[model samples]
Target: MWKKKTKQFMSAGSETKQTLHENLAFTAVEQYKLIRANLDFTLPADEKCPVIGITSAMRGEGKSTTAVNLSYVFAEKGSRVLLIDGDLRRPSIAKKLDIDNTHGLTDLLRGKGARIEDFQSKRRDNWYVLPSGAIPPNPSELLGSDRMANVLRQLREMFDYIIIDLPPLNLVSDAISVSPLISGMIVVIREDHTEKKELEKCLRQLQMANVRVLGCVMNGVKTGSASKYARYKYYGNSSRGTGK
Candidate 1:
């Protein structure tokens, strides 16, 4: 039974196959491959466009997870990468990466002696993290501040890629406000969860904000009827119903 479920989670369906982190260890390789290949195809030349944003139509759709994993993969390729938790209202990257959120972008923006060079938390290999220090009630205005833009510019000069994990486009204006400073944005949508209307609304929001959406990512997918690490016996045997 355990083998069967692992296969289901690893299936590459409408989802990106990253949720298996909690259940299995053998699936990490497949997920890493997906991340690396995804970046190569979607991202332009690193030198041409270094800053990018990872956003979603609504909350709880794995946008933060996407940003973190993508950053990890980019760093694995030997590129100096910075992953910033731009979702100040509900920052999750710091917790996800298990790093201290003592000071970050917000602290740096408020002229609290938090320079760009000071916010970086060197993790492993070439990866670094910038948590969204103390959550602010007024994230939108802060993100729009001139200080934030300057920080982004300084970061662009330092890292090969700067991946910002932002809040849901439908919930707050923060993502839209920060969009102009980045090279492009990627929207993450969950399978059977993101309605057509919601997606259209998100697109309209980005258009109104003048944010270029590079592409849409379908999360929580299912692929072949086999185990995540190996083939399962569920679909191959004639005793069971074959997937038509």
Candidate 2:
């Protein structure tokens, strides 16, 4: 059996560059590359555009950070990647990436005659972002709407990988509503802060919804004398099934 590993979470402030892709350390970059490789191994060979959702059980578990870093790594591999801020209630991708959120996913879904290209903001040669524009009053309804599905379908035709930074599962039903549309989900869990009971509840919810969970990313684990030192490694090994 393959054992899971934990790595020291790279603090966003330590990097002089605003985004991880700009000035990420070798270890930190390798960690995300491992995640990307793991994700690729889990994806179906027939699937052209694998849409992955990154979420956590609660707030402050580094879901958005994982999503951003994973997207960056995928784009770095020369694949056309689209990172969408699916967390409409509390959007952060735009601010984190230093891009304008005036128009994006919500705007495109509203059917206000905005082109998809108009909403997409390119940060790199292969990476594009669709921010959660203008928070709506009914986020759940909007996420579950048919318009959202249509938008995803269109996006699938354009990008090789679509990464969605979703809201925490326990916080709201938004993540659940959009779960069915994604190819798979990656759960982000804080090392010491995330409760086991809460994590169980979140996993149960995903199971009840029949969502495919790729695996869990244990974040913010301290690297100290007491640590076991399970080094981050990416072998591109085939997965027997989802959920680790």
Candidate 3:
């Protein structure tokens, strides 16, 4: 079942490269499901909206990984998923998915090139990725432009789910500019690495922008240990009634 999902999302490539990444993408499908299940319980009942933005409190916190894997898993479950690399300044989705970033969100937004469908890179299953395209000098401005909103609206009609990978909130205003366009936001923070104070500030920034923080993904968290349950309880309690 998982293999089917992975195959549905492999980018335009040779059979061998596609096969390799498909295997890699499926290896983390279960973990992706776990994250989605957690969010299922955490997000507000009315927030079943399909478009979601994945970001981080800081760089290298695994937001890209979370976004890519989540989209793959959701597609595996039969959702028509459209994953967008919205991090224009430092796009990583292309590399992660082994696709090109030469004609992604930036290109689509600038009116300098092709239609949204023309820019889409298909993967195994019902999964599709829109790379970040060229890194524009003014990414924040581009993200906030009306063109971006229009593109998103068009995508919403064509996809069952749209997952966006964004730059860390602390690093750029890109996330805030596009926040209103997404249904909710996921903040990824590496365990034992993100500073509590920084996390608090990031939350404040989101609040100021009036963005709905759907939840936080604690990356690099140790799995399966005597103390694993203890850690879960600690995080669960801390994040309850809050987006984490």
Q: Which of candidates 2 and 3 is the stronger one according to TM-score?
A: 2
Cα deviation at 92, candidate 3, in Å, is 0.9
lDDT of 3 by residue, 57-173 (tens): 888877776787777777777877888888888887766655556676776677776665553444554777788888989888888889888888877888877899999889889
Give Cα distance to truth, residue 126, candidate 1, Å.
1.2
Cα-based lDDT at residue 43, candidate 3 = 54
What C-alpha root-mean-square deviation, in Å, does candidate 2 show against the real structure?
7.7
lDDT (10s digit) by residue, model 1, range 1-244: 1111112223423243434233333454455445455555555543453687888889897788778766766776788888899999888765665556778888778878766555444444466678898888889988878888988877777788889999999988888988878877878877668878888999899988888766666665554535442210111111122211
Worst 10 residues of 3 by lDDT: 229-238
Estimate every model's Cα lDDT from 0 to 1.
0.68, 0.76, 0.70
lDDT of 2 at 230: 29
Better of 1 and 2 by lDDT: 2
lDDT for each residue of candidate 2 in 1-244, tens digit (9 for 90 to 100): 0001111123223432333454555666777887887777778878989998888899988788778788988988999899899999999876666556777788889987766555433445577777798999998888888988998999899999999999999989998998878888888888878999999999999999998888888776554523232223332323555423
Global CA lDDT of candidate 2, please? 0.76
Residue ranges of candidate 3 with Cα displaced over 4 Å:
1-28, 40-49, 116-122, 224-244
Q: What TM-score goes with each of the models?
A: 0.77, 0.84, 0.78
Q: Cα deviation in Å at residue 96, candidate 1?
A: 1.5
